[model samples]
Target: MRDPAPRAVTSICRALAEQIERGLLTAGSQLPAERKLSEVFDTTRITLREALGQLESQGLIYREERRGWFVSPARVAYNPLVRTHFHAMVAEQGRVPATEVLSARLMPASADICELLQLPGLSSVYQIRRARRIDGRLVLYVEHYLNPAYFPGILAFDLTRSLTELYASEYDIRYGRVRFDMVPTALHNEAATALKVAVGGPALRIVRVNRDQHGRLIDCDMEFWRHDALHVSVEVPD
Candidate 1:
């Protein structure tokens, strides 16, 4: 059967979301001007703005005072409580997952990072920054810190794939526990650029620390999820 037409602004937002997921619109791509969009959708400007507002709330688009809207990048949803990788999560949702490795390097751990990983000062660590996509939409910017001693040659792996899976196969490093801290914050300049949002747009700042089977720290990761493109749900059993 054919799908039903979207009913309201919420439905319009979902249609735009589908466009992003299918690659009809790409990250950093500017959306049509509001008036033009209204004409294209055969709706009034008010309804168009309402749809756009919903997209803005979801972090899929951002507005400038006079410049108009643009597509925001995608992000990966990392749930520390679940023992699954980002790729697995996307796959389970029937979405295509891809990674763009922005940079990977070995650097001295920062004081705070060292403390989080329980490593000594001057210890080298692998810093990896990636832009994650789901079904071709930019959804997240991920920054991962790994203790160099534990995951040696980490920089040599194909980062377009899952780091957690690579660690499991190559080094027998399997995570047994994880902890998370989630906070709501406004996007900063760099984060705004990566997520294709205006400065001060809503974002979810997530901090995660993972540990191996022996309870040793494996990695510390920071992720920024555009508020518009993600929804968090909790299911409780009675």
Candidate 2:
């Protein structure tokens, strides 16, 4: 025994998907009001929501807090092996990149941070929190933990600029021997609040441990990205 409601839901989902694919609903454009969509589809709000949820899971749509669903932009391609930093890579793709420093201060390293940075117990590190946007859409929330020994008076610089360039110019340090770890996760409260999404919404987490040209650990970054905002691509040579 099967309910007929799912058929309607599927129909609505397919119709809307086709419209999006045909560019009737442009990227970043909000969908019609639920009431209007329900009247147009002749379906209940529950079914409409189900279809929208399906679309969201497919990364074709996204919902903002207190705002209706909008068509998602095409994902940005990311190559972890590339040495280019965020600003450069985004500009190369013809997309605008913006970063806001949420907080920056000297903080005592936690146990995990100590282990990652190879710092002695009770050592202090410069902790910087940031929110990043692409084309005016909040896309990433990140925390940077930098070994304070390598950078003094770094807080005085424009924190919104590229830290990679800052490190080279200010500290004569170039990144070398970087490592990355990625996983799918639900956004935590802090990241969700910064990105303006639900606390438990799906996200992609990437952890990066970086070393300087002298082979000294310099920093580690934890990044939480909207699951719909990126496409990771790698090219390997034989």
Each prediction's RMSD over C-alphas, in Å, is 7.3, 1.9
User: Candidate 1 clash total?
Assistant: 11
Quote the lDDT for 188 in model 2.
100
Model 2 spans > 4 angstroms off: 1-3
lDDT (tens digit, per residue) of candidate 2 on 56-77: 9999999899888899999999
In the range 1-238, model 1's lDDT, one tens digit per residue, is 3223345566678889999889999977889888888767777777788789888776777665556787875544444446677789888877788889988999888998989998887888899988887776666788899987788887888987998889889999888788888899887776677666567877788888988899989899998876755666545558
In candidate 2, list every pair of residues with a backbone clash: none
Minimum summed lDDT over a 10-residue window in model 2 is located at 1-10
Candidate lDDT values, in order: 0.79, 0.94
In terms of lDDT, the best-performing candidate is 2
